[model samples]
Target: MKTNYQREITKHIETNQLSYLFIMILFIVGLIFGAMIVVSMHFTQKQDLLFYLNQYFSRIDQQEILNHFDLFKSALFSHLQYLIIFLLLGLSIIGLPIIWVTIFIKGTFIGFSVGFFVYQYGFSGLLFISAAILPQNLIVIPVYLFAATIAMIFSGQLLKKLSGRRFIRFTVEPVSQYLIVFVVLFGFCLLAALIEGYLIGYYLPLVRQLIN
Candidate 1:
């Protein structure tokens, strides 16, 4: 009996998977926008960082270099925070369009940022993006996906319960499932942010210079 119940719940979850798919589709759409931005910016913003590098190297000053690094790190972290919060709020809402718009906007920002780099450095820009952006995304994308899934399930459960529909008791199971997924998503966000801030922020500059 317990096994059968669990099977039913799993089936329900699977059936509702389309909610998650919608969000993912939005995310890919956003990524396309972001990539375009990166490509556009690459052409417009390409400057031989050599001059800037020479200027900084000539000064041979640790404090100024560290300051610039701090500024870049802060900017990166701020962007990450903004993206996470925007997506979280969007997913928490009860409408499909709201979620879709939010995901597209997020993807646009990402696409533009990456596209800017690609336009500037070509394949090297791609490398920079993979190093700088990909690490955090590994965690963030899945987190948002789970959040969207939970939000969808929660909304469905609420509707069914309120409608005085049959099988109202089944709503509790989905609610519990939503809560669990939310917790996991939150945890992944934290881990992703740390990796972005410390590993990528601290090390990427050195890596870039070394390669150059």
Candidate 2:
């Protein structure tokens, strides 16, 4: 406990954790603000968001669980769309704004979806939300933030490199690290997809039954 090296390592780890937390908070503020924007829009704008939500939820409620592989493939396809965006965010320093924009979309969609479900179904919608959204987002949202944070760090490094600053490193190491994180994050996404495709199918009908 008294060793200087151990203390230094611990200190560095704690500092890094704090820095990540700060950045995550900033990202969350942006996300929540985006969500609030959807929630706060005037009647016409809300009508547009609501129009889509109506179609989406009606389709969701009417969906029949099909073949396992087909369902998994479908779920995987949806997750992959977001995965591709995160992959791009990690690869391109210029895509930080893209990440921010995607985060906004994510937040806005979740907010609008939740608001709509609650409005349409009242208390019963919470069960639908729990069944459909909670399981995957539990993993996916962290991965989103984690990927965003890594991209933010790399973007800063790229800026330093552009300015010809010394003691700054860019390129391969960061990219390799990003790829590693991407692989791990995608693995989690795969798990979420599996849960969404197969497991949730079983549970969602049961949830609807309880609602009835």
Expressed as tens digits, the lDDT of each residue in 13-96 for candidate 1 is 688778777777888889897776544544324455435645754443333444434644664565456445544453343544
- Which residue pairs show collisions in model 2? none
Candidate 2 per-residue C-alpha lDDT over 1-212 given as tens digits, one digit per residue, 9 for 90 to 100: 46996896578557568546855666566656655665567878767866885665455567744355677788778777876776776566587677667765676567666665665566787777777778877887787777666666666556657778465654587678667777877788889878877887656656665344
TM per candidate comes to 0.65, 0.72
lDDT of 1: 0.62
Model 1 / residue 141 / CA error / Å: 1.3
Best by TM-score: 2
Candidate 2 global CA lDDT score: 0.68
| Model 1 CA deviation exceeding 4 Å by range | 1-13, 37-95, 160-176, 210-212
